[model samples]
Target: MSKYLDCYDYAAIHAQAEHVVKHRKKLRRDVVQKYLDWFDTHCATSKLRFQQAQEVIPGGIEHNLANNHPFPISIDRAEGAYLYDEDGNRYYDLLMAGGPTILGNNYFGKECAQFIIDKAPLTGLYSEYERKLAELVCQYYPSVEMFRMLGSGTEADMIGVRLARAFTKKKEIIRIRGGYHGWSDQFIYNASEAPEDAACLNGIPVECFQSTHCVEPNDIEALEQQFIENEKFGGTAAFVMEAIGQDSGAVPLTREYHAAARELCKKYGALLIFDEVVTAFRLGMGGAQAEFGSKPDLTIFGKIIGGGYPCAGGVGGRREIMEMLAAGINKNRDKKVRVGGTLSANPLTAYAGCLTIEELAKTNAHETLAKASDYFMKEIAGLTEKYDVPALVFNHQSILHIDVAGSQHIPTIYKKDDPEFARQSKEASQCVMEFAMALAAEGTIISGGGKTYLSCATAPLVDEILGSYERVFKGFE
Candidate 1:
């Protein structure tokens, strides 16, 4: 087993599901009422704001992270580990801007903004910070020989896939279901465990996904089978996966699995692409690939890379593969595929990223955050045992996950191959939302699914954070 795999205790998680099976009704009644009453009283302004937003915004929220059960919290200001909503409610920002802002919200190199105030923001050209930031990242992630900044993580993955195809002169790419590599047209298609449900592929052309294939993580046989099938076309170009496993490591792939996966990709002449969007800085400076002991041909990064700013991600790897983006490298300059944004590598984002890494190194932020995260994960895991709740809390370093019935442990949570587990999983999902609202009521806001993206800034508030979750779980008993 991978040391990463040993980090969890699924037996305890699976054992707690019986409580959910036994007390579904009571949990629903109490948790729902508790959250509703609290939201009505405390988040009145947020509800009104969401209602108004619904008139214009498609989902009544800017992004899914801001969204909650009935509505989402509207942020007025944030500092360190806390966010203040429009309604004057304060929340412990567990989402941490969806796993970036490692040093905390509004942190852009501390003084970089002041320094850049006099300098031009963007010239649509090169800047010192661009080179400086690239140097900094290349120092931390030794696997990446060269790098290119992009508008978003999605953009990185889009180009990464294109680069893989161009480099190998191959077509098909294998991806893990329930894995996130950005929401590009190629990736959004059937990116879940339930291969039958292509609902997420609604607007994209079905033919666009003809070259993309899905396989569950840890299933080397299925992965190999996909590669075999792809050979009928042009052969596999790359195998892309979140190095920590799918759903941001909610379902972790074992050490042996990763080793086998690396071998499988090599056997079939496919590049191994590690999508480290969430795990880039959250799991440590080296990221999940280091933790899992797998080195891939390419690595995709986002979140903290740009230090919570626009144009905040990139693709990095071998010099030969990355050189495909180099224009002045050879006689045929135009042969290089275009793969950058107008604002990419701008001074401001680079300054932020440079300072972010500097701070992480100087203050030893990763170590502090990891220790607190250890406490938080184990504490939340103990909640199931302590209060007899049906949910399970597990994490990879600072990235947290709570599966209502620990269904993430059942091989694949994407399909209903096991009907009873599926039913309980759905119920537990509802339970998770309620608990999230409950946590919100107590001033801690996590993602809709209860992912607590912790930061070292929140280390001081661990006791209070734990108390908020403990109170909610005990309410169920």
Candidate 2:
């Protein structure tokens, strides 16, 4: 439906995925050992700090991305395209603070810090900046005539799902298999590539997944079948997915697929929800929905929404559906979604979010990011070829996905209960983690060794990063 996505070659991406799965590759054991040795030698202070942190902090990390092998590198400071570790080693940042720093780290921190100094962080009440942030979101996201801010992406997803159920008066929620909405109980049903496998349900009860259904990405027939199957029960509430596939486009989806999904939702009387947590402003000011030319009934926002600040999540959509989250007394309390957060829409995050969006529009950051990513992706293709590796690299604008070992697609390749599945999955995961370590050792950082969230500020580092990838590739087995 939209030519904006012509830049992405889905056929090439799928071929890459196939190649990696059929012939999985990883860093050589000696090469991986060398990378580990480098971490032990160069990141002495970071190792010490993480060891100290283990006494109190679980896994010596607050974020999952920080859980790296040989202990995570403790960052002392971040500026532009680099992360300065406590050990004084500076690495080029391609993670972009886990996909929030679109304009780069601390781009608008000064203004936001000044705002915090003037107005404080929280007031436990209304703030004009909250209205301003919501207005900014609504202005860009055409599907969102109204918006409601939340504390994090998880919270936003929780409420978005609730709003869908409330609006449709249904009990079932359908999500793409392997798609992650959040850590919320209902939404985390199928968090892996395995269809209907609630593998992450440690503390979550089995009944929490009753109303959730999983469908593989790009399977329009499977999706429509699930909706039809739901009709025998309570009918479908919503069909939610990461527009570009799971793990932020680790498996890419096409515009034709998205358009079909949109129509199916309408035909089945279910709302189409786009989980744009990582893609929101990164895809464009208007988001993935705008680029795809398909309007979702509700859109979830996070990460860049708060401009890399806290309280960075929201759900926005058509007025009638969003109005279900309205505050104040209501006689129809049972009909409305009950949502609340003490720190949501606080002064600090709100002002920063507003400034970030304004800057995104003013600076034309997307154009810069697009050009930079084009260069980066081109180089990655060359590196993969030169290394004689089965890896694949592709991008949805600035959100670049480099499938080193095809770990993200493992569940799709192997049955979850297969005897070889566990072994293959573990090996693939290790390969990915090791690859990420190799990149970090080469003065580059990415998300779990697979995903890279580039920013306008990181555009200048394209050549440097290409070199970094080549160095890492040289160490591959």
Candidate 3:
């Protein structure tokens, strides 16, 4: 219920998280082994495919999402709400292609395929679809007065940070710890990896990371302190964060806190940048910013915006800030940042983005998907309680977080140096890996580390997915 918490009871959620982590060790060993044994028998074909792919693909997989524990399952094809693996097994698609495909696997597959074939995938120029897509984004999202497309969310982040620094003429960027804002160098500071390693910052040089300030979420005082500290150096360009907290709300933040942060940014002459790559079409057409009523000066988008197509991300915001990327508007447009890509706004992705956003808006998909997500969370939470499962089932909009390792989602700032955090992170990491493998064998595709996405088509499959989860949970003893 912290999802519905008015002011966000962080202590309550953190306490539950700690209890669950400690409890995970008590789960039956035989129950887990039983599922692993089942995987060996049922996933023979997938295992063979992985063995063959390792010769070509670096880790036998291309993307991090496919990084399963033993080996990832190779999907053959997908329909509305299900994925069919090469082993001739079908699994409920809880991942939703990592939070796109709101209308399902192939919302208008035939039409889109035919259109791309008739025209061209890349004509080396613009399409009406590009303008149409931008129009739809600007119309649905109040914050997006002007928009520009990029290849992926990572590219959008790189571009967005540059735009922010350029527009504000400030060098420092303050982001919340554990906020995953794509793999851009600036944002990689506190994203993806464990929070404790934020200081070392491997690969990225010190000068690069020194331009950004990282702070823990849910504490306005810490943010204010960071703001004060930045005054000693250059001013902050932006205070960028996910609409929800890190890991797609693994650590949720209160509405009041976000508003306060926005005010702090205003006080320090920094742009308030909300990375809406995951939340854009899911929380609302205008994204989480709209749902929470806390507007941002700039917004970054990915995944759902491209409608499960390639080149699926962008940045959009107020006219003044967005127009900074305008093409050839000024010979001295070097004053404005230049954002360009080979396939920046190609027709295929533009059409997919245009059609996807239009359908989501017209169908009010968020309302339906939210109900489905909440139902899954509520029922699964009860299922965990009844079966004594050591997992926490909760969600922010359609993105669910299942704490298989049971560690605190956002650990206290002080705990970074504690051995307690390391132990819990290791335990939860193992549990999550084994749990994902178990779910795959039980006929569900989930993100490896306790997170998965919901979509408009999730309503009908909830019971089947829940039933599978229940069966698997009981087996764990």
Candidate 4:
């Protein structure tokens, strides 16, 4: 039998579900009430302040992702791997601003932030920092010959599709199922379960996805079949996808699959685009393409490049295609793509991005961060085994996924005939949610969607985090 099954059976035999419930009961209501009361007396003040702000700020939070259950923790400050909540609650932060802040918050160098604050945020003109950042990015990703900066990953993905259409003179684009390129109209299809048949977000015209196609990851036959059918309908422009499935929980594409994809794109007369917004510097200095040894026609990047700041994204690749931006090919005569934003390549964002990349390169921070992530995965696995819990941890460098009740061991994508496997997988995802809620109450803020990230984390932080997991899991015992 497979090693996964062996591990599962061993855990099943030793598992005591009551241990988890009994410990949970020990920390139940009364115990939680005492802390809640104390928090109310101390922490409720900030909660009130944020609630008042909500009248003007829509959700009382700048980013929807920051708003969490029990109301969001109004963070007073953060340093390294820790966040200081308004109530003086210090907790380990695993979300890391949804996978940015590789060097952690407030570490983007005081000098850089100060310079931007004094000089200005946006100049609406070309700045030296933009050129410097582009140069740095090109040094690492040689495929990016001529690149254009944008405001967010969403914008980059949108513009990337436009560029592909402009270059290839084709309309249709292919995306993998469950891959989230962005909230844009063209590339938003098949992202989630929606009634729209195409999975396109509301407000998007149905025609936007008429040419877009969806394929399952790791399924070479299905991918080729889509290409064959798409060609009959006027050919495909590009195959855009996250090089390392970030939103889908770090589900890596096999080397053979990526290689096959590159060959297929060439065969179909379509451009290949790698959406590296979350995978960029996190996987390595060269990103997923470098790690996987596959070359694509275009690439999109964000997140770590911004160093936790806003307005970070860009598209880069073959000179012939990227130079189209300068060649007046965007169906506009002003020699500019119709897609320029007031804040695209803003001075402040550029400065932060440059400094962040410099730090990442100088210290080899990605390697260290990967080590911390490895430690985290191993410790979590060991803890699950020791506690006889059916939890599994999977990771790629700094990104991680927690699959409670054996979810990690199951294939997320399976053949249609494999109903038994699908049923088991669905149950495992449900179990993950339960364990995640419990972990959150214990003061560790992992992503609500069962994902986590590590940044500038040290060995000591790993030990502390694992200890917390051990304590929390022991309660399950």
Report every candidate's CA lDDT.
0.76, 0.83, 0.78, 0.71
Residue-level lDDT of model 3, residues 24-54, one tens digit each, is 6433678777777876888888889999999
Error of 3 at 81 (Å): 0.6
Window of ten residues with lowest summed lDDT in model 4: 1-10
On lDDT, the candidate that comes out on top is: 2
For model 1, how does the per-residue alpha-carbon lDDT over 1-477 read when each residue is reduced to its tens digit?
001123344434334434434454324476668778988888889889888988998877767676677578778998888999888988888888888888888875447667667776788877888888878878878788888888788999999999999889998999887777777778886554333446755777778888888886677788889989999998999999888776677666667778988998899999999999988877888888778777889999885788887778988998999988854346766668666477778788888888888888899888888788877767777775676665545678778775554434443432457676667667666766676777788778888766678887788788888888777766774
What is the total number of backbone clashes in candidate 2? 0
Give a tens-digit lDDT track for model 2, residues 47-76.
999989999987788887787776789999
Q: By TM-score, how accurate is candidate 1?
A: 0.91
The collision pairs in model 3 are: 405-428
lDDT ranking, best first: 2, 3, 1, 4
Candidate 4 global CA lDDT score:
0.71
Regions of candidate 1 where Cα sits further than 4 Å from its true position = 1-5, 8-28, 109-112, 192-197, 326-334, 407-425
What's the TM-score of each model vs. the native? 0.91, 0.95, 0.94, 0.84
What is the C-alpha local distance difference test score of candidate 2? Answer: 0.83
For model 4, the superposed segments whose C-alpha errors exceed 4 Å read 1-64, 193-201, 246-249, 326-337, 405-434, 458-460
